[model samples]
Target: MESQPHNDRLWIKLLVLLAYKTATHKHARRLSWSSQTGGVIPISPKLCIKATPFTQLAEANAMRFVAQHTSIPVPMVHCAFEEKGQTYILMERIEGDTLAQVWGQRSDESKARILRQLKGIVEQLRRISAPPSIGVANVDGGPIFDHRLPRKSSWGPFATIQDFHRELRSGIDAGDIEDDASSPGVKDMASFHEQAWQAPVFTHGDLSALNILVRGDEVVGIIDWETAGWYPPYWEYTSAKHTNPRNLWWQEEVDKFIAPMHEALEMEAIRRRFFGDF
Candidate 1:
């Protein structure tokens, strides 16, 4: 029997398919589903479309900015349009295997090479200067603050770091609590918030193995720029560290792959614990 969630997903897929069909007159025979549950649907071998209720304008712009400013490989955006209250983005389908697909079979040397490449990419991203801010970037390349965890809801494009930390502290206080010993509750959001962040820098915002595309040993593309933004220096590290990896090795050595932000990561870990993400 099909599980409830599976059935729900199928229904949503069907609705999306119908919508796409009506809009584009495309045939399902040429279309396929991506591993992602919603929004992202493959329309052709060399192209895919991502549909979202909220505007994906920021994502589309982010990709262009990254490609232009840095050598980081992001998918080429062919088109972006809004229809029926959803934003649809058609983009190039990168021809490569996701790092997650090949990580386990890779030799230690290959893994190290990939890590080095990623570190270089991170360095490049960090070089993109931005006006001081503590949240996602808008289409104008200005700061647009939004909730960091559990949701993408907008909050404030805070002018000061203090304002950003105040929002974070509030979130911590209202967040759920956990009983695990390894998972500690954040007892002092005020004290925790006192730590100063270096100037804001461009961030990919979500850096998981699955989002990294590799052809053989070289990284060919980095997909999903929806969360790309100008943020506090620690945002990239903490956000990347917020994942729950299926690969144990990834979970173990993630800190080594990217720049280390121990204090920020610890804060995120505590937040995740409170929210039951672990």
Candidate 2:
């Protein structure tokens, strides 16, 4: 294993110690500040907690599903509940730097190793049996008809790929595709809407490097299951690619790590162009 720098390790150890102390104190305010990924507070060396404005029951369930059914490295959900308009999740804290933080510092061989692990993880996820519906799965393996969107309101637990596609084109149906229907992207969406998709499968929904934790050449954990659900097989590739479209390096990461779904990406690109305003 390629170890993290000595100073980084020391800093992490210190944080863990402090967090452990706080958690051990029975009445200590359960608060540790993190501005970037809001409401995540390290509670202890072994556990962390997250408080979010949105409901995290789904996220907790998703993490549990992955942890139980697959060999994928993910945090163990200790407990999750909703309170005062916020959901709180307490989980195990897997220690590592995010792949995003260290990818550029790695050797090609290390990168390849990481990708192989991720490929195995994806294969395992696909092996999970899914129902006919296309949507997020509940804890008991039922579809959640209203899946939350990354940017705005919930969208689907669509019955089919066509239903999902129609939802994408709904902006035009609502007369909001764009200010100019003549815009090339708008016109492209109209054409792309007719494309078909393969049967639904389990998807991470958001699989950017930031969500993948790395320790040395190994993938220690895959985090952020908030958007995980059942979707068309190509959903993973298209969604990961969309995370940082203009960043050439991230594009390379998507290409190297995620199986390409050119047609799917093309359709997804069109959908975003059309409904992005919403």
Candidate 3:
């Protein structure tokens, strides 16, 4: 007879295989798929699953944190678990077209109304302050996730804004600027970054129109909390500005809701130029 540990391993393998089949089943509707092995699929009318090799527990935690703290509309997470190396998130299936799908056709009045609602939501997010100990972190005080970062994965719960800025500069300290003369801009940018020590606020690190779900002119849901975390005050504005070509129009509208941080934007541009926008 097989040992109990071996049987448990076999059971896990079978469960993962079954989940993979369910994700690829004919009836399942694929929401998004990576070029590699992960994607989101709706197995039933009301139940959706997001499966990815990367750990998604942080995303789930962020969503739950937002739901509890604010009145913002977000999908209800049923459960999150890891199986064989893939993380599966079972959540409510929010039904609506992405804001991107309807934005182009919307009237100026309709767009203004939607932006008003979004501004209110952003204000609510900003109102939530991070505990002093947590500093810059995910909802649960763990390392934050942002694919745009060089690491492209979890990085830090930095004790100070300066520490977080150093990481953003790819470890080039303002003091190190004297030693490394290749990038003179780093010193100025790092100094500017150091001057602003605003307490970290809850940030939806990615505010793309594609992630907002809408019904008519109403925003029914804000999906995709993978990049949500407690970050410096300027983070939301900077991240919103770093939009894709398709989202250029949305980028123009970002400052309508989020207050413009001109200096931080300049610092971000310098950081991107020197370190690359990865």
lDDT of each: 0.65, 0.67, 0.77
Candidate 1 CA-lDDT value: 0.65
Model 3, span 86-168: residue lDDT tens:
66666788989888788899999999999999999999999986776667877777788776787557678788888888888
Model 2 lDDT vs. the true structure?
0.67
Q: Locate the minimum summed-lDDT window of 10 residues in model 1.
A: 1-10
lDDT of 1 by residue, 1-278 (tens): 11011122444555545656654444334443322424566566787777755445667777877888999988887666544556666678788998878999999999889888888888999988775444434534544533455344554556655565656555543234333466444654345655666666888877878789998889999987776776767877877766544556665656776768787777767655554352
- TM per prediction: 0.76, 0.77, 0.86
- Please provide the root mean square deviation of candidate 3 (C-alpha atoms, Å): 5.7
> What TM-score would you give candidate 2 relative to the actual structure?
0.77
Which candidate leads the pack in TM-score?
3
Candidate 1: residue pairs that collide: none
Runs in model 2 deviating more than 4 A are 1-34, 134-151, 171-196
Ranking by TM-score: 3, 2, 1
Model 3 ranges off by over 4 Å: 1-20, 27-38, 178-184
